[model samples]
Target chain A: MVTLEILAISMPISVLLGIALGTARVYGNVIIRGIASAIVITFRGFPVLVTLLLIFFGLSDFGIYVPPFWTAVIGFILCSGSYQSEYVRGAIRSIDIGQSLAARSIGMTKLQEVLYIILPQAVRRAFLGITNELIYLVQYSSLAFVVGVPEMFAVTKTFNSLYFRPVETFTTLAVVYLVMISVLVVFFRGIERRLAIPGIELTTK
Target chain B: MNSNIPVLKVENLKKSYSGRIILDGVNLEVDKGETKVILGPSGVGKSTLLRCINMLTLPDSGKIWLEGVELTNPNTDINKMRQKIGFVFQDFNLFHHLTVLKNVTIGLTKVKKIPEEEAIKIAASALEKVHIPNTLWNKYPAQISGGEKQRVAIARALAMKPSIMLYDEPTSALDPQLVGEVLQVIKELSTAGMTSLIVTHELHFALEVANELLFIYNGKIVEQGPPEEVFANPKHDMVKKYIASIYSRKG
Candidate 1:
């Protein structure tokens, strides 16, 4: 129930941050893209354990004492945003150049062209990546225990400590994650198949 | 043809790619309501020349005046100038995701800032002019035939009410049977006195429709006159050789 509560709070924030940053990376100019690149490298290059330890312990030295749940949410949102940015960039770039040209030929301003023509196609292309990231979010929700937030994995650990049966506790947790992820995968695949364009590629991968 | 200050004029046009010239110092003029066809072999810069008319290619050096407005000036509003000049590409270049009606209405609403209902009304008339059925308006480009796609491309351009239409090998991508259908649409436009510059390989269509024909070869206008004089009299050796090559291929 703690993990479920954490996911309910953090998942939407993670997705929203991912989309906002990912969109900027794709449409932003050279300097903006460079900055976004640096942010992504810093977040993704460090191990999640190192990031959590730094956020929880190192930040206290700077007189920045963050609550455990908020700290976990911030860390996960940054990590998820970095991981998903590349997928969005690839999807936005993969759209046919002709679409933009067609929009321009019709007298669309650069802003209008991006908002009306380019973004719609790019969003469709990015849906599969977004779905994959959702699965990663579900799995990564387990990592919130490192910050002492007591998510699903934390619940299993407590159960194991009480019962002295680690195998049974972890086995049940594994089955739960599996069922949840499979349900999400099937649901997304159906949506993708229905919205798929005839000529354009369905996935960048 | 009405010669009212030459609705479209090209002077000393030149285009080059990596030090190789494609349109080398070419000059031409089109009076209002005249259909001028630029005939040439592939790679002779026919498409590039037409592209220059709307600043799409940005000619290396040249001056194009449309309706007395100088296009070569850097200060010129290229978007406004392009809005007045319509272009049909060899590949159709229709938006694959957009419906035929949307494709036509896009320019009207976006460029002209016309109201949506008014734009739709204009697009409908343009589509009707191209003889595309109103039933096909909602279809995507992938669902349409090459001929129908080209017609939509034309309608998209015509929605702007352009003063001159530039066609770059409009029927080249169509099947042999479908080529006639697109050419017929163009022929109707020509008869309606729509000013046009067409770069085409269809010698017979050029002969039948063009008031003036230019035979371009080796990046130069090797022959220019009425189609009958250039195709029949054969003053230039290069022109004769090209006609013979085309005939041999047909045979």
Candidate 2:
């Protein structure tokens, strides 16, 4: 339940942030592009655990306090969003330049070109990378336990300590993670197929 | 909407890329309902001229008027101006992700702010004008043939109901067999009294559909007149040579 809650909070926020940052990096003017690039590089480079620690613990030192659960959510969003931006950027670049040009020649403004013509195609191209990121986010939810959020791993640890059954408990935990990841992989595969372009296939090897 | 004003006019248009001149003081005009074909050898700024008319490639120095609006003025709203002049590309640049119907309707609904039902009505008529069957309207660009893709592109532009249509080598990328269908559509548009400026290498199609033919060479309009007159007289040595090469190839 905690794992699902963390994912529910983090995934949508991260995806939206990633799209905004990615588009700014690709199409924004000098100042915006530079800022987006800096954000993406900084968050991608910093460790997620350290980032969570910084938000939850280090910020209190500077006279700001955020609750532990929200801190973990913020950390996951920042970290995942930066990585997601790179995938989105790659997908946007992979689209042919002619698509935007065609849209413009038909009298669509630049914003309309990106919104109607470019982003739909870019999202499809980014699908595989995005699904991979989602899986990573699911696993990374376990990191919330370190910040005192009683998520999946945290609950399982408490149960294991009380029961004193290391082998059985750990095996069950591994199986649960495997089941969760498998469901995610299968669900996204269906989406990828449904949204697949009729004549073109995008594959990541 | 003034009948006296030419649909499109270009004067002293000049453009260059990296110290290399492309269009050098080029000038032309297309009256309402006139079809003008621009014929030139490859790399002679034919496509660049079309791009400049639409301001897709801004001219280094030029004046362009579409329906008497000074498009060259910096204050002109380019996006709105583009709605008046529809442009078709050499590569049939259809939005690959969109259905044929959506490709045509997008501009009408989004840019023109027409209601979706009205846009669909206009789009359907435009597609029908290009002879695209109703069955193909739901298909993506990649699902269609090269010729059908070009027709879809034409339909896309036509649905905007522009005063003038600019075709930049509309058939250049097609297979030899596919070229005829695309050219046939353009020929029909010309006969239907649509004002058009076409850049093409197809000498036969130029002679057939063009009310006036402009032969560009070395970045200038070297010869231009009614197609029949230019073809028969061949005033310039360069034009004479060009006609000879095309005829020899035909033989």
Candidate 3:
């Protein structure tokens, strides 16, 4: 339960971080983009288990005793944020250069242009990628068990150890996770279909 | 009165991209309310010239003055100068996310700070001028035909009510069947005495509508005069070769 709450908090926090980093990767200057890319690649290249251990255990060695739950959440967010940045960057680039030119020609400030014109279009483009990332994140929640936080997956392991009925306990946990992701997939697909630009084909010929 | 102080002037315009000269030492002038057509062969920098005039493409070196405002000067206010000259792109760069009405209204509302009600009213009239029905105002760019989108782009420019309109091959991207409607809309604007600088390949249309014609080649004005005089009499060998090629194609 504690692990689940951490995962839930991590999900939204990381999504927001992903948006920020992704937007920077797409629109920032050379130096800012370089830093953002380094952060994204560094987090994504390493294993989540290693990352969690480093944050929860390694930090304790340095005299910092932060809560294990927040540590897992931080590690998960770093992992998710990197992947999400790629999605946001790809979505923003998919938009036509003409759109930005048209906005600028009309005297819109650069920030105003992005806020009113580019972001709306980029958001619509990024929706599917974000949904896919959500599915991935739900699966990633299982990694929280390595940190000794008793979420759904960790709870099942405890149940298996106590009852010695590992098969039935693991099966139930797997089914619960599968059902949750399936529902999320269906819900996001509906939103994607409804919110997509009308009559505008997403695929380029 | 004082020759009406040419609404636009370009002197010694020079531009190059990666060692290739695009607009090399070009010069021209357009008086207030006169329609000027720039005729050029493909890749001769006609569009680049227009792009530079609007500051859409910065020139390496040049002087561009619009409505007594020095556009090419380092001290000039780009946004302010841009507001006074509405540009119509060849690709009809309408905001794909916006409806025809919203595309037309955005600049007016956002840049000019015009009241929403008044901007909508102006947008409606501008669309009516382009012959796009108010019923189609809510339709997105993807829902409209290329001709309709071009007209919407024109309407978007018109809504700004700038001192001049710059058209870079306004009808070039249209299908053969759809070309006439956009040309017809531009024809109507000519009679309104609006200052217009058009870069186009429609020779007959340029002859019929423009007060003066400029023939550009290799980023310089090779020949220019009243359309009738330039077309009827050959002054330069390059101009003669160009005209002969077009005439032979028709023959």
Question: Across residues A161-200, which tens digit of lDDT does each residue of candidate 1 receive?
Answer: 9998988889999999999889878988888877766554
When candidate 1 is compared with the true two-chain complex, its DockQ is: 0.37
Q: Is the docking of candidate 1 incorrect, acceptable, medium or high quality?
A: acceptable
Q: lDDT tens string, model 2, A1-205?
A: 8788889899889988888889899999999999999999989998888888889889999999988789989999989989998889998998898898888898889999999999999988887887788789988889898889998889889999999898998889889989999988898888888888777666543
Report the lDDT of model 3 for residue B4: 68
Give, for candidate 2 chain B, the lowest lDDT window spanning 10 residues: B90-99
Best by lDDT: 2
Q: Residue pairs in steric clash, candidate 3?
A: none
A1-205 in candidate 3: lDDT tens per residue?
6745775798788888888888888778999889988989989998988998888889999999767677788888899988887888888888788788778777777776887788778878877787778788888878888888777888888888899898899999889988888887788878777776667876454
DockQ (Cα-based) for each candidate = 0.37, 0.81, 0.59
Q: Decide which is better by lDDT, 1 or 3.
A: 3
User: What is candidate 3's lDDT per residue for B1-251, written digit by digit as tens?
Assistant: 35567899999999999999988899999998799999878999999999899888999998999877789888987886787787888899888888889999999998889999999999999999999998898899999999999999989988888878999999888898998888888888977888899999888789888999999999899899899999999688878887888888878
lDDT: worst 10-residue window of model 1 chain A: A196-205
Error of 2 at B73 (Å): 1.1
Per-residue C-alpha lDDT of model 1 across residues B96-140, encoded as one tens digit per residue: 657889989978886788999999999999999999999998887
lDDT of the candidates, in the order given: 0.83, 0.91, 0.86
Name the lDDT of candidate 3.
0.86
**Where in model 2 is the C-alpha error above 4 Å?**
A203-205
Q: TM-score: which is higher, 1 or 3? A: 3
